[model samples]
Target: MQDLTQAAALTGPAGGEPRLVAIPRLAAGGRWRVEAMRAISEPMLLWFTKGQGRITIAGVTRGYTAHNAVFIPAGVMHGFEVGPQVFGNALFFGKDCTLPLPQAPHLLRIREVHAQQEVNVIFDMILREMNSDSPAHERATRHYMGLLGVWLERQVAKAAPEQTRPDAAKRLVARYTALIERDFRTGAGVGEFAAALGVTPTHLSRCCRQACGRSAITILQDRRIFEARRLLAETRMPVGEIGASLGFTSAAYFTRAFQHLTGKSPTEFRRSV
Candidate 1:
């Protein structure tokens, strides 16, 4: 029963009368008020109906205005500040909603009148289904969300060559990410990863920079740091043991690295969470 209208997550794909898409009512004037640099594991789409504000993803900030549908990939740091006159629909899909989901954050404005109207209609239908008492509510919600994904993909396609990636770039990053997820605990560097992918380190880093908005080393650091936070919050592991297990040369090394990137020592991070 948490209010995903602002900031949230879901276990997986929605079941019924799913809370996947609903209009977020802002506090007081109209601000989302989630500014901390935290990672979300679920993919999300944000559609703004009016007003403008700043949306920062991966340390980049952009203006969000009416009819802007922002596609946020899973496992990235993002925050939002909506202006007072703004109201919008936010759709939270589990990480596995559909194939070709964006692997990075992108903001696209729905410029066509018909496309804008269609998006508005879909959001309204989703809200209605979520409130209904029908047995097939969840099924209906899934259908609508699938449609949302299709429209979003088209919008992203228009922006891919400029801000995002082409299919080839996506494939390369996908392979790199898969290898990192499987072997990050072993303390592999960009060179080792590039070797495994059969590409030079420079080539791999170029792909990551173009496709992920960050360098290859930064991506590895993020994956490691995200896991460190998860383990610190979810388990009772000792700090030193966590460092050694994550392939850090020493406990002090791990602490320094975590602090440098997250601005918090491991213990401080654990306490905050």
Candidate 2:
């Protein structure tokens, strides 16, 4: 079960108005911003028209190439690596979006030319309505969002099922990621998380490595660091408070960890951004 306190924190934009916006992949805050493991308050759709890279969602990593569409629901941990040759559009459906969306993440490899054209048309229409000064443009945008959802549904339904079921390692790692998303702010370490999941720290770490090629501790730290970066870039929260809120024992330690992972101290990161 999700902890109510943490789940509440996950809902709604903490600051500013809700936004439904679309921008090119390169404009979506660059590579590190997208390549790190993190969750956002809003759902997002990525339409990859060119290039290829790896993406991790729900603790599973997969390669993505051109004509691929990835849908990530709000509050789910996801990240992707895109190179200079990569090109695409990323559409963000705001926290307050009322349109029905898949509860899980999806990566649809669009093989049919007609299907690719259909998705392109939908994206084009969405961009058009968003940039238009036409009356009820917001409504038009909502309708287009619905169409995009429908497109995802059809593609997901048509896709072939996985050849093999999720193994024990994958299942355990998925659960571990879910718990990290739930209580990462509490500063719980790998042992505590493993205990809660009814496994020893060694076993959990082994499974995590088997599933995602990273140790359990590394995954937990990545999550915490991701939140630290978001707070530094998006808000005026004090450095000490941000670290404390993320369960860091001291400001100095937070700075060290942040610098080690991000190559910048908290203050320096804030300044650079």
* Top-lDDT candidate index: 2
The TM-score between candidate 1 and the true structure equals 0.60
Highest-TM-score candidate? 2
Quote the lDDT for 175 in model 1.
Answer: 70
lDDT of each: 0.69, 0.79
TM-score of each: 0.60, 0.90
Q: Write the per-residue lDDT of candidate 1 for residues 1-41, one digit (tens) a residue.
A: 11112222321123332254333452331121243333455
Query: What lDDT score goes with residue 86 in model 1?
Result: 72
What tens-digit string does per-residue lDDT give for candidate 2 at 38-157?
A: 777888888888989888887778899999989888777777787777887887777677777888788888999999999899888888888899999878878888898898888887
**Stretches of candidate 1 exceeding 4 Å from the true structure:** 1-18, 21-44, 48-66, 70-89, 95-108, 131-135, 146-175, 206-213, 234-236
